[model samples]
Target: MSAIITVENVGKKYRLRHQKTETYATLRDTIVRGAKNVFSFNKVDKPTVEEFWALKNVNFEINQGDRIGIIGRNGAGKSTLLKILSRVVHPTEGRITMEGKIASLLEVGTGFHPELSGRENIYLNGVILGMTRKEIQKKFDEIVAFSEIDKFLDTPVKRYSSGMFVRLAFSVAVHMEPDILIVDEVLAVGDAQFQKKSAAKMESISKDEGRTILFVSHNMPAMEKLCPTSIYLEHGTVKKIGKTEEIVNEYLIATNAQ
Candidate 1:
């Protein structure tokens, strides 16, 4: 039970631009604006830039086979932290070390190509998750069976509904036998039955397979049941990390106070 993942003093910063002019302009418009700024006597106001910190001084260590839940109000950087851990985005400060392969289902069709058929995206996403073609093939049928998207397997994923995308993506991610699994709130798109199935699957994998999981969700009960440990984030910082029920209750009280 050594630590499988370590996040040290992580922080992410985003620059928010507030511009009076349109953010996107055609080539002709850009040229014209450039000429005005270069030669015209009129002065143009510059867009205002604001610095926003999505995560600040966040630090944690996840043990092998640990099931951890992340909870926070909107804008608390929970998703940002997950993205950093998934390598989809890097932190503006600090460093992270990971010991094993990771599969992340952060959003609908996260690593999928919209123009690719469902079957194609499955292989494509599987590869991105560090699975070899042979490994993916071995689990192909199981993934398809769990997703229940066989009929639409040949269809381009662009045609799929959000729920369909989530089902297929989740299926491939979890079935890939990744050492670490990261799931965000995209599971909300699935139906209730599917959510239950997903929760059960996550629970089983962590217990039976010794897989590590980092889950982010607003469903308090599900988080409590699936994750024995939880972290509560507030204003882009780690507010608390401890037993799931205790952290959940503290979050509820804090949220109610605001």
Candidate 2:
């Protein structure tokens, strides 16, 4: 099968500034500081900027219908890589190429408008995913039933509980039928039954429908169940990539050593 996603030497950098003075200053204080600086022989030093690279030199290729798990300790840059793939953020360096349409559920209520009711946001999110009105309407009832939010369908999502928000968002994302699905750990917000449903749905979509998937999770058992291959990230680099069991075992050993 042809590869659906390719990532090459991807890196993301963030700049942090350290300032000596308070961020907010009154007009009078600002004037006095300016005068003092001008009169003094020594000039005030500028704030220092530090560059932090969250991801560095990452490379991978994912084929169509592949179910891959991404695992790492916190601050491993897993989230950063996913954000780049989802097009939420651009990489500081390197390149990524993807085939077909992409739908990502990186967090709860990712594309939802809080002021809009669940019913309205469904259409809005569908459009954002490149679906036409006809496509959204045809799947509307099925999406609502899967989410189990029919009672609050007309209620603004701002009034929803976190669980309700996740359920509704996940329903819309999966049913939209993108060529590739990227899911982060947001499924942890749902109840056990809902999590099971989500896992099953993802498995079905990748297997039966031949859609590609990128899944990130702390749940080892769940990853073991849903993913045949795994990538272990450590300190913004791919430490290992292979069969799920081998990669997961290596991760466990490293964690114990830590």
The runs of at least 3 residues in candidate 1 whose Cα sits more than 4 Å from the true structure, single-residue gaps closed, are 21-44, 111-116, 155-164
lDDT per residue (tens digit) for residues 116-225 in model 1: 99999999998987789999999999999999999999999999998889899988888978799998976565899998898888899999999999999998999999
Where is model 2 poorest over a 10-residue stretch in terms of lDDT? 40-49
Query: Which residue pairs clash in candidate 2?
Result: none
The local distance difference test score of each candidate is: 0.89, 0.90
Checking candidate 1 for backbone clashes, the offending pairs are none
Tens digits of per-residue lDDT for model 2 on 1-258? 778999999999987667665666579867876787788777565446789999999999999999999999999999999999999999999999999999888876657999999999999988887688999999999999999999999999999998898899888888988899999986675899999998999999999999999999998999999999999999999998999988888888989998
Report the CA-based lDDT of candidate 1 relative to the real structure. 0.89
